[model samples]
Target chain A: MPGPGEFELIREYFTSRFQTGSRSGTADNGVELGIGDDCALLLPPAGKRLATSVDTLVADVHFPAGGDPYRIASRALRVNLSDLAAMNAEPLWFTLALTLPHSDPAWLEPFARGLAETAHEFGITLVGGDTTKGPLSITIQVTGACARPLRRDGASAGDIIYVSNQLGAAAAALPVVLGEVTVSPRQQQQAETAYYAPEPQFAVARAVEGYASAALDISDGLLADLGHICDASQLGAELNLDQLPVAVLAHSLQADAAVETALTGGDDYQLCFTVPARHRDAVQALQLPITPIGHLSEEPGIRCQWHGKPWQPRGTGYQHF
Target chain B: MPGPGEFELIREYFTSRFQTGSRSGTADNGVELGIGDDCALLLPPAGKRLATSVDTLVADVHFPAGGDPYRIASRALRVNLSDLAAMNAEPLWFTLALTLPHSDPAWLEPFARGLAETAHEFGITLVGGDTTKGPLSITIQVTGACARPLRRDGASAGDIIYVSNQLGAAAAALPVVLGEVTVSPRQQQQAETAYYAPEPQFAVARAVEGYASAALDISDGLLADLGHICDASQLGAELNLDQLPVAVLAHSLQADAAVETALTGGDDYQLCFTVPARHRDAVQALQLPITPIGHLSEEPGIRCQWHGKPWQPRGTGYQHF
Candidate 1:
């Protein structure tokens, strides 16, 4: 009658749904205990290592404060899933710590639905979570199983860099997401899809698992994330701007502007990985959607080349502070 | 020069400390990869189930917004560790999703040290985390290893209930913590320690592992949390108020007030467990710091008895929303 209290809200929206859902046979899925417990008990696959990552999306900082609850949920989970993919892991179980401003059923309904659908899609189960009252934010911790886990420090000087699919659509979609730009209905839909549902590169990760020596998901733009691989491996990289696979939405902008967006746009959720020369043929034989965009070098800093000439972007990447 | 960007801040405060510290041999400890990666890779103990839980503590709602960062970090991690103890799990690894209003080194320094010390104290490792910009909040997800887990659904009607250590100190310390009341230096220190450094009942959990039927950490309150065990096990409980191990700080209040606080005040982080009559002698023989508070009954609701007379407290526990 009073829209339920904290426990009731969790029960009605998350616990009941997850318990009765198709994936409720938790023991069969390595979950010995799940929701409605102090802690969820899980059994990681026998010989495989567990790959775990955590990410937090705060209202206004990560997304619009009053954005669509469904989309927000989708983005938050997917963004975290990307990290597992980067590690070349298979999706397993996840925990969500959701802090909300109030117990609004309107917000809870769609958010729960979105999370359930996404979890089902990714073959991940919502094992356990804590829901509290505070400023809206979602902290998702995902654990997966990996046999041949990809890491960011295995790259060598002769390794080539590649990225899955395209980039910059999510960054370009910001204008539309924030209502700063008016666009055609089709463009709006595309922008929303790109922004809310950027696919994690699980398939690419699997395709390049044995071949890729270093990898990470691009959440802080290509240059920034590539810098991570370089820093970890003690190497640098040289990007081939002509080989960049810019998203169509970003292509709508001026030529250089599109390249800048492709170079420095965060939230792409694309995999950026490195493969040694010996594994190049093997990786290419898989016919994956990934494109070779750069090459790790012994140099200590990132360099850019446009059509064989030296180049530099206007800025680096998104800054949290 | 610029107070370090996000990456540099993380490296300077967290990564460098954790890497060069005594726990750097991650592989020997089952952490294949720790911080500075897409994900933390871990190998769960050979035949043990993994118990995991997540908790989000917000500024103002959970604690004072501008409180000492060191104690805040300690409380956040210890609170999550309590869940592991409740499940009879040994602390393993944890991830922190910290949302800060800004990247202030002064705040980060103490917080990281506090977290590192707590991790060392609990024999846990800091696996991975995401630091972002937002209203100050800390979301901690802890994973532990367990052979025989204690679950709330295992209790039977005839099981005797017990609580570890003491209760009501944390709740009573709130006034002192918030500066609403003043006391002697020793009292103030005791209040702060009770409020901030709640010892997760891992020892108690281990002692009762084979004998206890069910258990959980007393977070919301003795009455409310025991209600959880009741709802899960489909049984009720009659709390013997006279038997409660009222905390020393709480004893400063009136007799009834101390009992009431011990009954309904929360944040004690003590374990409440049930054991069948058959295991009573074995448990008592262990001589653990536990007191028999009540017993499970065939009834459907929680009942309280104060010196053989029914009693009701003014409030149940802390309400989140």
Candidate 2:
């Protein structure tokens, strides 16, 4: 097979990966404008504010070295999108900074394909970016548009807390990193797929947009993440640990271990939120799979109840420092 | 002196550097509630659109090895800010992804101080970023706000051309890289300062906001960057090489060498713009040290006039690939 040069790589992977017909993507009439230009132009809707966030996935720190590039592209972009979702924003455009060891055609093909697939799924558009030669790293800065963004400081003391999707899939897959448990053929495929392709809760994010008082997508663990809410809102929470929606496989672990993993393990990509008690009915009417884990309080710090016993902070979550 | 630990180093150098007092900064309040949170909570101003751009500065590729860390931080942040300037935007916030060789407090102190100083200079605040252990590289994603952004596609065939400041300081500093010419005490200070601390033309960008038909900061060299405008606007340009503003020192070199350096050297953080002939007088009246180096043509490609002869393309600008 011919090696994928930069042009072909971008065309195949990034050109149509996100929603192409929108203001953020390539012009629908086939005008070739994107990362190739000095800058990418997006005709944003009138009166709407643009929300932006940037995150980097390093080789050894964010992802394991020599892992699948396709998965890396997918997870890296999705995690950034999750941030936009946390803001109740619609993903619009993104800029990618890719540092590669060398240009390998085999890696570029699948990687671009995965990136394209994820972008199409999210309705985002590729705007502008820089690619360089260096150690393996990918930094994606995503921009989204918000009608009304839910901020961290907006949570009142009486608001109820909620989370989207099950937590700890990526952390659960970390055994593949430590080699504590060997995967069987089927399990290897399942675990690896889950590890690489954890879904971003875009629909839930959109659903809870105006109704949410404060929201954040869980990239770090739930407890640590909720601590951000406490700090920002200057209030405390009493989380019902049993209410946490852990994955079925994770539930099989010992109670403490399951809680530990759910609380401290990172890379969940779920949305943790606070909503007023009055909006509970409206929130529940959305019919999303949400876990009402806790409620905001006048007190400061996190307190929990697990199996009717007092839940204690178990471990530190992912600390990049 | 005590060694800068990771936390204190971050607190002293990185955290305290950015000005959060302005609304464009993280929030009007001095505290960024999202620093240790799972995600940051940035309050985008109501009714205004957010503009963002990301660029990475690598060790060997972007900067010379053993280069001043303070200057590296300044240049890295300034380059990304230049993108915002091209859009006629005011920088609001930035997120940094720093990869370090080792935790050297001395290096980080200077580096952080430089980053902080630049951030304050632009009235931008550092909202949130990640620090990791890896090879030496810095990726900065800057977010700005645009009331009326000037895009590259806005230029027309009859627009007059202009550029702010001289070109090729970073490229001219290349002798320091090859070790062909030893940097003298004064030259070393100037060249190193130019190479490291590139001043983003924020004032020029703001001045040209409504007047410039199409505009972009000169990053990849004059000819190549002008080519971007031509391609975007579907037009060509005829540059007067005699009017090409070279710094006094640059003009001291041999004529051919000086022209070549001006045409091909990169890292010039000047603004290149086009204005309609009707507005030309008004633009020139700004008295901003701008030079009318060229005129846009209905034809398609860049041409330069020198000694009453058409000068061929001397060299291609910096190619990351």
Candidate 3:
């Protein structure tokens, strides 16, 4: 419902930059019709199911209300793409529903640039989007193609748990990102990079697809998300806290605080997955940057141990409400 | 990041009511996995293309902020489904991204019930959703299957344009809907019903699938939406204003005002489509309750004639910006 001039601006900044795949007459991108239509037409790849996820980021609630639009756009998309990675789905097409307080080219240009760059980097196409007037929030729905899907209900007792790369970087970076703390310039750069662009583990997902018993991306902290796998699979988990990969930025804190942040802080977007004992060797041979931090058990709850003593984190995860 | 209790509340109200299709263990629904997962897995029906659309409706901007949640939910979904109807698509699966001011059961209960009822009426399943803390708004992404798509760029110079059903009801009802005007209780009922539940033209879309050269739903009034067809098809439109099927509610106004409302009013949710001359007989034979209001022309802009004299409406359409 943007006015003529604002509509033109949207077309120029967003639609023009994403004029590839179906919109540009490409035959292999799965998009039959993209933007500038009532609905985007898509042909899902034959013999593969479509994996789809939706996430919304609200200004002030999820991220700073008037922060750098470029970084905000990057984080919004990367976090959503992480959902596809957890499902072992190869990214295909996505639709965006964006609500803005106003149409300002200064803010939009960088945001669209960041979005286009991320879409290109991930090899995904923007198929459709809606722009509305309101408080700033982004709702993105990502669709992907998957032959073998890793689901949360597939894990069994004794399955070995793994987390890709590391955790707590984004959590530790939040204070700096929010301008609440001062740090070295190099550390500031690292904080912004980790918070704004947590990489989606598509490669790890592909490697673990057929082998992992269950998988999910960590959004609401490791222990909290691990609890989801437990509830879904009707099992429990036992974590080795000493072996946890607390992120480098988090290492700036005290040893126990770093470990606690890795356990309970949110927004890391790493992949938390479980593999059966039989596939541990296979997954290990893949040599992906993953760590064996825990194992599923029949204890019916999540438990942690450090130096042969039981450990407990202060809070479980960030709560939305 | 809802707390355990709030998550339980969400699961009870929203998820429990939508326990059908894939989640209910029905293999024919094309849903491999539904809610309570990192992503929803779907198998698109063979030999059909997927048509998807996303729309976000903000409280106060799109509707009364504290109005009936049931009516709001109904209007939100219906408007989005109309996009699928414009593409000649049959309803399949959908995802919801909901932002709420707070987790109030009073609002969530009716909202979920209304959404469930509407989804049942339209035969669409809720496959995925994201709930976040923010200002109230609902973004629904609907996907459907279509054998043949109705596009905006297929109209020819001699194509006859038609509108399914009547227009101006929702626009004329806005005053009563917002409680800014006084009217009879029956009139108020009619007004609310028209505004809240504008029927999606699925049947009309099916009837015109093979015959309509170009099609789009009229959310931004006849002149504006038809201008889109003109722009895309590289043609103009000539309308016979006397033939417009203005709504009953709008007829209560003065003649010219009513006609103007029908021409420029938004939220009708009716479809304006074009059929080539060759398909006129076949389309007329379908016996739909549609009126031939206009035709495409070689000229480059929209023109209107009233009583054989040139005419112009005051405003072209609603502007979001």
Candidate 4:
């Protein structure tokens, strides 16, 4: 009961927090005409269709309790945006369901600021949401639009697989949770930044819109996500571990640690996509830091080559069950 | 951890739960291809735009902790579907976010069955969702489609207000939580059924589409829901309690109790709409057993008369904060 009432909390933390993007006309403003009404009305662009995705993050399961609300809001919203990015969609509106143990304005202010900053960055507006008192959890359902979305089933055999940015920031940030390694003042800044605030690959997603075959953002790690593409396209893949865009493990604790982090660690909000081999040059010409990690194959099982030896997944990657 | 892992539990309970209504197409369809994917994909019909709404039900906050999961699923999903119905949209797909203290197959089986039944009845496909280990909560986000959705702002001052079904089954069912009233085998069956299984006014919504000025389904109490319409239209209302569709409450409880429940109980899942005064007969001919509870006024405040005297909300109907 210490928290703001659901209506006031939504008004203070969500409704009054962000500005609508330029694309949303003044009539269809950031605060849609229908927010406080029964259901919010969204006007998608004329030629485009709507794309939607929902994700829920629970305390202890998704984030540590007592973590900064600012970071939690950032991470929670960003992950959903990453999903939109996977489909090469432009985020238009989002609905949040925030459940908290108690309402605390002190905590809410920073949280709202974080959410607003991210919403502004993504050009998305917070349209409407439900707030309730309960254990700490955030469920975000984002609606985006795509002229032609890059889907998992769109990949064909022999398409080259590419990944944006480096992997394992979130996995490496896990040490901050366990207290196994004390983050230095600067590293704490770096690790916490990466742990809490994942940069959604929207720019890269937009850049690859017309070029990529099948695309999805990396949340459950590279191998697991590639497995999704395989299952969807009914194809196999051969990953070159040597070509994986991960930081050098030797620079940190153990040599193989980075591999484990890149393989099974979750919460890396990077883009994993497959493009036909013919478009490799066109994709590369975008001058983005993308690494070809694998290739889709005619066969039907995931295989990897590490240190010139065949490699199989040692454990299933990031099982929520 | 005693509950089944997220994957196995989802596979066992949710993967094959609902039949995909869109299976005539080539897309790999099983209730929208859920569970083994990064994000669920739902394909709506070509001409329809998706209308989405989200609602969260918390333990002790929304429903009691040890309550039946079947009812939880039914009520949770129905409330969300009710939002879509309010928009005069046809139900299409829904995503669920289930947070539980433990994974109990006993709880999930009935819950999934309830969700499947509702989805089948409404022609909605269960697209995707997250299952996390945490405090008990259920967050459902449902999407439907419509060519033209009814807006609250469309209501004019002279419109006659109407509501389908009677109100207060959820309120009458509250005694089961307080243990004040002993529930008989039959009463228990009815009360529990009412508490959990709310029949969304989908047929009524489709029948009254284009006939109603502005519409919404009552999940909050009658006064509270009508308040939304009033707030949106910038108008007031005068309710003649004598003409209210109070049969459901009248048949179930004592006179005063029925009146109280009819006014203040939540979770009716019935449509509350407005129709222009001139078109009232045409609206009435839809013959959905609707009652002319009130009339929208040029003035700007809500007023109700009970037994020829003024009546106001005795207490806050239901507060999530």
Better of 1 and 3 by DockQ: 1
Put down candidate 1 lDDT per residue, A290-321, tens digits, no spaces: 99998999999899999899999998898887
TM-score of each: 0.97, 0.82, 0.97, 0.89
Which model, 3 or 4, shows the larger TM-score? Answer: 3
Inter-residue clash pairs, candidate 3: A1-B320
What TM-score results for chain B in every one of the models? 0.96, 0.91, 0.96, 0.91
| TM-score of chain A, every prediction, order shown | 0.96, 0.89, 0.96, 0.92
Evaluated at residue A174, the lDDT of candidate 3 is: 88
What DockQ class does candidate 1 belong to?
Answer: high
Instruction: Estimate, for each residue in B158-213, the C-alpha lDDT of model 2 and write its tens digit.
Output: 79899888876667766764455775677766667667777777788788787888
Ranking by DockQ: 1, 3, 4, 2
Predicted structure 4, TM vs. truth: 0.89
Which residue pairs does candidate 4 place in steric collision? A3-A103, A321-B5, A321-B6, A321-B7
Please report the candidate that would top DockQ against the real structure. 1
Residue-level lDDT tens digits of model 4 in A120-147: 7888877767888888899998877666
Relative to the real complex, the DockQ score for model 3 comes to: 0.72
Off by over 4 Å in 3: A1-6, A21-26, A253-256, B1-6, B21-28, B253-256
Worst 10 residues of 4 chain A by lDDT: A21-30
In model 2, the Cα lDDT at residue A221 comes to 83
DockQ of every candidate? 0.86, 0.31, 0.72, 0.48
